[model samples]
Target chain A: MARRSSLASRIFPFVFGLVVGAGVLYFFLPGPPQGGKVQTAQQPGAKPQPGQQGPAQPAGSTLAEVRARGYIQCGVSTGLPGFSNPDDKGNWTGIDVDFCRAVAAAVFGDASKVKYRPLNAKDRFTALQSGEVDLLSRNTTWTMSRDTSLGFDFAGVIYYDGQGFLVKKASGITSAAQLNGATICTQTGTTTELNLADYFRGQNMSYKVLPFEKNEEALSAYDNGRCDAYTTDASGLHAQRLILKTPDDHIVLPEVISKEPLGPLVRQGDPQWEDIVRWTLFALIDAEELGVTSANVDQQMTSASPEVRRLLGTEGKFGEPLGLSNGWAADALRAVGNYGEMFERNVGTKTPLGIPRGLNALWRNGGVMYAPPIR
Target chain B: MRWSWTDPRMRALVWQVAALAATLVTLWYFAAMAHQNLARQHIATGFGFLDNTAGFGVVQTLIPYSEESSYGRAFLVGLCNTLLVAALGTVFAVMLGFVVGVARLSTNWLIARLATVYVETLRNIPLLLQLFFWYFAILQPLPGPRDSLTLLPGIFLSNRGIVMPAVETTPSTAAFVLCLLTAIAAAIFIGRWAKARKLRTGESFPTLIVNAVIIIGLPGLVWLIASAAFALAPPVMGKFNFEGGWRVLPEFLALLLGLTLYTAAFIAEIVRAGIQSVGRGQTEAAHALGLSSGQTLRLVTVPQALRVIVPPLTSQILNLIKNSSLAVAIGYPDLVSVFAGTVLNQTGQAIEVIAITMAVYLIISLAISFAMNLYNARVAIVGR
Candidate 1:
């Protein structure tokens, strides 16, 4: 009887202690966000697919709220060079980074009033939809499903890209068609994986895909001969190829597998916020077409041309309807150079990536990047 | 209320029911909130996505899977891969743990200290870093398939993967296996009967030799009878890769190595504690009975130590299973990698995918505890 009681006593206290410890730990954990942070949801479509539960309180338009908040929280790529990578001083620089600066300039009239949220590919849309960021200027592709189903508005195509492969020169693999039975390395949870699958299947070849959660891991794995080819957007291949140990040894394949129209996206519900982001992108392109560089944006305000005057926001009230001052376009242009200038500075022919404008050049330049008039 | 408080049983029942109701209410509230939030966002909240095509390829699938397969099949493939790694990892860990645990207690200074250093170094470093080290630093840098390190005549190692021979099962091979299993069962039966007979009579049978003959000789006879039916198919070098036999891909090897080495560190310490908990008097008692060291350890120590070992060992096994989710970092395509990482992203069914994945882990952890508890109870001491 004594032994049984002793065993019971021992078991009871340990179990009780564990429960108590768990309770204490739970209380010690940081509580959920308070102070008007609303619960957010993400779906893909015009209508709620299964159910719809609106917020308890109307938080009002995302525009007024961002203005009230000091800075625009811009979500960007975790670290894609020439897109949204950070420098040695932890300052984010890239085409995507410059686009965020343009958005900040349009809203707050100061590009410096922008904070960056480095997000993974999978979480980028969610971050935008949840109001964790004012806008997602990541190197995200615009698709019909993302526009209608996910309830997001793609501002514009910032860069036109296509899926391709990088292989070692010594491997003598010049084209993706020769990559039959090849093992491909790429980042998981992205459209890149699906594109690779479609590309290989369409070519009537069998291949294996080894996916990593991070781009760096995938790159290193590919470098180590763990895979025969690495696949991503052509621009990403160009940018990331520089990091290879023997950068000159690897060559990106010739075939472009899938259309990747990379752009910035905002949530669908707020028209004002959507207009602000869209026109800001347009103003950058318009400024580029008008030969208005950031260095001469303030000087160009005195130009007599109606198009330049309207694009600089001096001849029209386009900024008024978008809920910003008249100099919103001018501010955006002055903060980040025109689209072409920003492209050249970060990832174009002048940069180490040495990428030709290709499909990203404007309409007059024989590329498809055309923007609507500011007026 | 005051009158009921005088009765301890009544008070206990009231508190218990209240607590149960509170837990149920909390659970219902959260579930409802999730449903409402998903609805508010226009996010489709259902398991319908599981019926859609997976459309992506997994690196290694034990079951039949293709791009045309449904997401449900993909989920199963991921589950099976997870179970395979966890089972193999646990088995390898226990074996390694026992050796290291015993070595820690050895009288040899160098061996004991080395075991100590191994345990301390591994247990302190994060498993993720260790996994990266094994993958990037060790496995990834191996030579290409054409220049594979020949481990043996039939085994090859390379950056592509490890190639080894696999058995080519034929019609007579099944018979050989069944014959071998039957021989083991007969050997156990003879051992039991001989033990009973020896207890009854002073005379003894040579049960050891007889059991060995039944176990080895019977299987040997089956093999001899069907000699031509079985053939060894060793891995052969091809132009670009191995032509035949099984290939242990580098990702799988790296994940398994990381999991086994990391979990074994904790298991070894648990074993060391369990063994130490056995009273010194028990060992001394076995020595006084003139039993050999091995017999003493087998009869007196291990069984007693198991009482202390099983509980913690169960936790470590569960930990190993959970830690296998980090396989995504190295692209092993385990449950989290395939289902949660890939499928969740593809379908954008965050809530449902997360819930289903959580339920799977819960079921697996519960199953482990259930099996371990049954074994634990059997070995538990009974009061005289």
Candidate 2:
């Protein structure tokens, strides 16, 4: 009798626990699992629930969510001087920051209604996919894998860039060909690392690479002579050189390597949100081609040209299809102006970066930056 | 049958069952929720990504690797780097810890005070700051490759790394190594035979000198015979940097130095407490028997102190290994930096990468714990 009681005591809790656990799980179960196409976030303001059934469509869920939250969540670089950097007064400035402000103006009609989440190169894409940010305006390269398999959509190219090298002037190395058997430092988890590998292989030269997780670390290593050269985008090399200890000592090599079309990105499964971001970039370029500046935007609203009139939302109601007011383009233009004004204010020849508008210029002006018409 | 309501045994059983059921339900609900969320994101969940090509380069690799290698190869390289630092750090920390700990209880006042200062300063400051100081402040200020600090005819030190001469092996190099191993085995056998003989009889032999002569003489004779074919390859300064030699990276040196110094501080305290646990009577008794201070420590006190020291020392070694993940901050390419940071970013498979990384650390820690526990059992007191 004693042995039987002891055996029961040893096994009773586990058996009882299993039965109770099953009952609790049954009570909390969602509806029956479906085996057809997976449901996407298409219904505006609909929270994610299991067993949801609907055809995947762009129902403006992201826009409705942003409206309910009263602000746009934007992901930018940690601190790239001319791209997306914070000033001494905690106010963000540069081309990427101004682009987010333009989006906020189009959505809420208030350019100040935006919050910035500073992310590193490694964490930028994940932050956008996880719904931590509505738009990632950091200088991210658009690749096929990221746009499809990684579940993201590239809006449009904001900067036409290419990989370049920065070497010290005293080294007397004038060209990229002289960098054979050199030790190069670059930021990790970036296209710059892969491109460095590809370029060296194509040249059939031996070199070593040191990949740091941040830009400043890589630059510091190069400055301290731990590396013979530093590599990144051509514009990045120019902007980062200003912060080095001896900016005049280093010179950017003339050879351009892989093409890097840097742009903003959003998560997949939301066509409406993707269209809004894509056309916002188009509106900036279109406004520039039509001779409309932020200062003259109010006057352009009454312009005689049909193209300018359509873009300023006077001749057509194009904003309604994107779930915004008819004055959306005018508000966006008033907040950050045209693409040319943005480039000149942040990184053009007049600014510290002094990068020329070579490939980023409009197609009609012998550059490849062309946007579809508003009509 | 009827049950008694006021029986203490029955009341305790009812409470236990209820608590068990509640805990199980909570765990089940969380696992279900995670499953649902992952399915909704449509992110692939599995270890299949390990076979894909890793298209990036690592600063240092222990084995053969390239951009065309698989992600699995990258993970192994990271693991090797981590193990190298952790193993070397543990050996150096224990040696330093014992020396400082013994100095703390010394008869000299200045030595004891300096030892006290070292322990207090290191243990109070954070390990991450010390790593940054070692990497950026001290090492980064060194000269470039053009003007390297020449330590010897064949060795150079600079901000890039420490370049040293490497041995160019000949056909007879394997024969020389075999002779060396034979000498080591002979020395161990002779030492054991000498001890057994001393126990049987009351006479001692010159065992130390004999073993030293055999170990050195046998390897020296073999090397002399192969000198005609052997060569030493010294580093040559190239236009960019040093060429054709073995180099030790500054990142590895800084991380090893920081980890050893920080862990040795805590270990010094544990050793001090252990030595103090041995009673003063043991030393006094050894002195009355005409044992010197050195003999008293090695022969009488340390064996007893080992009973207390081994357990806490095990935990300190474990802490050092886990702390090596901070190598990412200094760019050492340890398991966390290359696998969890870079591979996770490239593959975007957070769940699998994180799970595998955690399992690796856990397994390493468990293996260390198992070995230490066995050692602890052997040294433990045997009650009558």
Candidate achieving the largest lDDT: 2
Question: Native-vs-model 1 lDDT?
Answer: 0.84
Model 2 Cα displacement at A83 (Å)? Answer: 0.7
Q: How does residue A281 of candidate 2 score in lDDT?
A: 92
CA deviation > 4 Å runs, candidate 1? A1-60, B1-6, B200-227, B236-240
lDDT by residue (A176-221, candidate 1, tens digit) is 8888778899998888888887877788888889999999999999
Docking class of 2: acceptable
Over the full model, what C-alpha lDDT does candidate 2 score relative to the true structure?
A: 0.85
Assess each prediction's global lDDT (C-alpha) against the native.
Answer: 0.84, 0.85
Off by over 4 Å in 2: A1-58, B1-32, B226-230
Q: Over the stretch A121-173, how does candidate 2's per-residue lDDT look in tens digits?
A: 88887798788999999998898767655667899999999999999999999
Model 2, residue A142: distance off in Å is 0.9
Reference-based lDDT, residue A85, model 1: 96
**Candidate 1 Cα deviation (angstroms), residue B213:** 4.4
Residue B224 in candidate 1, Cα distance off native in Å: 4.2
Candidate 2 lDDT by residue in tens digits, B136-211: 8888789997799998888988998889988788887787788889999999999999999999996798999999
